[model samples]
Target: MSVVTNDEVRRELVEFLDQRQPDVVREWSLLRTFAEQRTVDAVGGCTELLNSLRRAARDGQEQNPAAAGFDDVRPMLRASAGGGASRRLDLLSLKEPLLRLWWEHRAGTPAVTDGALALSSAVDALRMVQLEEELTAGTETISMQRQQLTELSTPVIKLWDGVLAVPLIGTLDSTRSQSATESLLEQVVVQQAKVAILDITGVPTVDTMVAQHLLKTTMAARLMGVECVLSGIRPQIAQTMVQLGIDLGDLVTKASLADALSYALQKTGLAVVSADQG
Candidate 1:
């Protein structure tokens, strides 16, 4: 039910930091080393944070000094999160030294309660900012990983001249299907491929949706003047396709990639024959 003036809190905080400078430096040095080992960049490390704290305390009369402190370390926090460091551990390492210094220095002061309360608010603000940064960083990381996975899942390899192959593995979700279609289409243009092979041997199952995705991809390749061949038709998938009434309607399907490749080579006016056969 009591109010603490910014000026009063700032004075107390400055004194606290100044008095415990030695301890602060020593603790901060250890934290800096830890951050460097983890991040290799000291831009938003302990030293920068200490500078921010000092600036925030000096600018106590500002609207939100704690927020100012958080801004300084925001970039560092994001880097830590992006690097997949333990957020809780990083926070503990950063906050413990400052909190210990405050606790030791705030004892027996005239406005001890008010100073403690103000410091607590500042600490809480920093924690909240850290959480937000971590969340943003985590979301960005997940998005990047998802894109990498998509690329991995739908790998379009240049099997031979004028021929490209996309080996699809796993369940064909809408997103993955879209990605595959785009990647194959792009490769068709880039490679000037006359033939594109879609091998789904690693695919676990094929439903109507999977069938539609294949149709769409082949259609796209056709528009680009490239013949798309669907390979890796196991018995179970063929049966499912028939039962689901998924009409692949004259889009060339092959039993295996080797067979498809052979067909493609033949179309390109090439042939593979054994020396003994010759």
Candidate 2:
């Protein structure tokens, strides 16, 4: 039989914990190191843990890993913030004091050993639930951070009146390319700018695939009534574009962002002449 499968063991363990609930919470709360005391929600979390154990001890839904009381742990874990290996060890550490008390209460008896085993299983179950929830929270946090990073990397700048620019600065993979395009188009529609600039000065290489991404973004902007300017084409990149026979087909290209900005200013019926010019 499984450790938690014994009815008599569960009954005895629950009763012992109920009578000495305060003691268990008090001792477990004391085991915290100074850092843990500050990092974790100490006394309250310990009380919640003890209560969860007692509930799990009698909970018929305990057969499933998703026990009713385990859900209570999620809030505590969220407040803990750094719920990594140390937290897990601390959870297991709780079992020791409770077991010691049980041993002292009924030393050298078969019932003592049995009840100890049951309590250990219940605590371990609670710990596993906490660990699982921590992992889930961690994954969600990472995904959100990644998305924020992507948005940061692909920013749409309102460079001039009726002109917006996207200075892509890394490998233009399909995902990033799509993100860049979406951001640029949204700004174009929002600002209703006349010219959209896709500057590739920081892009390391220009290949057929890269060219395709540029063309798709350009065409997308054009469909929205915005003329797209492809800038940052060095001599080497121009040569590569030619050798690869990647026809831009009347796509306006510029040698630098300065030139692109000048062209955009002109196309929008604007100018950047000398300050002294009449």
Candidate 3:
């Protein structure tokens, strides 16, 4: 795509009008001849000329998809195709000059303004197409980004083959809670995990919502035939839980990830052996 800068377009227009005076003068003479010679059929001639120009513009856009401002040419040509024979001839007269200016980006050409205008129109058309493409792509982009954010924030880990670790970090709102439930359930099925660990060492605070979310994730994992062990309760959090009357009577709780792992191994019949004794 050739980019026509504002300065370059201005200079070309100046020089074109200076040197191409005669060519333009000649086109005007032809228009006059057509108007006088066939004033009655001038409209027909103008229609034919406009049709030819329209076809040429279409062909140009097709041939060079990347050509700057190619799309705008057709609409402009259409807009100029109104009224009597003389007006139509005037419109037709613009075709050759514009095409010439486009093909040869040189100075001393009188039709520089037409060329510049066409280029501007083409740019506008291309922008519309580009905007549509971006909007379409945004949906996919948001989904992928949300997944990445989940993966980064959630401390869910897959220990070896059938064992998993999910460390909860930061605040778990309703959305995060829902996501955590979904993720744990999917991973259990996909990994066929026998044991899953829920570690909350990095959590700064705990509330009813977060507690509820954790409970949901645990239950969902169990439903998938996976055992879930909650770990990493700070002393302060434990006190807060007690004060808030939160009950984990049914849920398995461990002091840390290591303790949870040991428990999970035993539950899954994965015994820890001493290598030195062997």
Q: Could you tally the backbone clashes for each prediction?
A: 0, 0, 7
Which is superior by TM-score, 1 or 2?
2
Please rank every candidate by TM-score, starting with the best.
2, 1, 3
Highest lDDT: give the candidate number: 2
- Checking candidate 1 for backbone clashes, the offending pairs are none
Tens-digit lDDT track of model 2 for 99-158? 888888768655777677677877778767767777777888999998888888889999
How do all the candidates rank in terms of lDDT, highest first?
Answer: 2, 1, 3
Two-way lDDT contest, 2 vs 3, winner? 2
Q: Give the TM-score comparing model 2 with the true structure, all chains together.
A: 0.86
**Of the candidates shown, which would achieve the greatest TM-score relative to the real structure?**
2
Q: Which ten residues in a row are the worst by lDDT in model 3?
A: 76-85
- The alpha-carbon lDDT assigned to residue 33 of candidate 3 equals 33
lDDT of 3 by residue, 1-278 (tens): 55665555545544544455455444434565355645445444444433333333333442233444333343333333332334332333444554464446554455456455644443344434334434444555778898788767764568757889877788877777777777777788888899998888988888777788888888888788888888999899999998998877588989898888888888887867799976
Error of 2 at 250 (Å): 3.2
Candidate lDDT (C-alpha), each: 0.77, 0.81, 0.62
Q: Candidate 2 regions off by >4 Å?
A: 1-5, 33-41, 60-65, 83-89
Single out the weakest 10-residue window by summed lDDT for candidate 2.
32-41
- Model 1, position 33: C-alpha lDDT score: 39
Flag the better candidate by TM-score, 1 or 3.
1
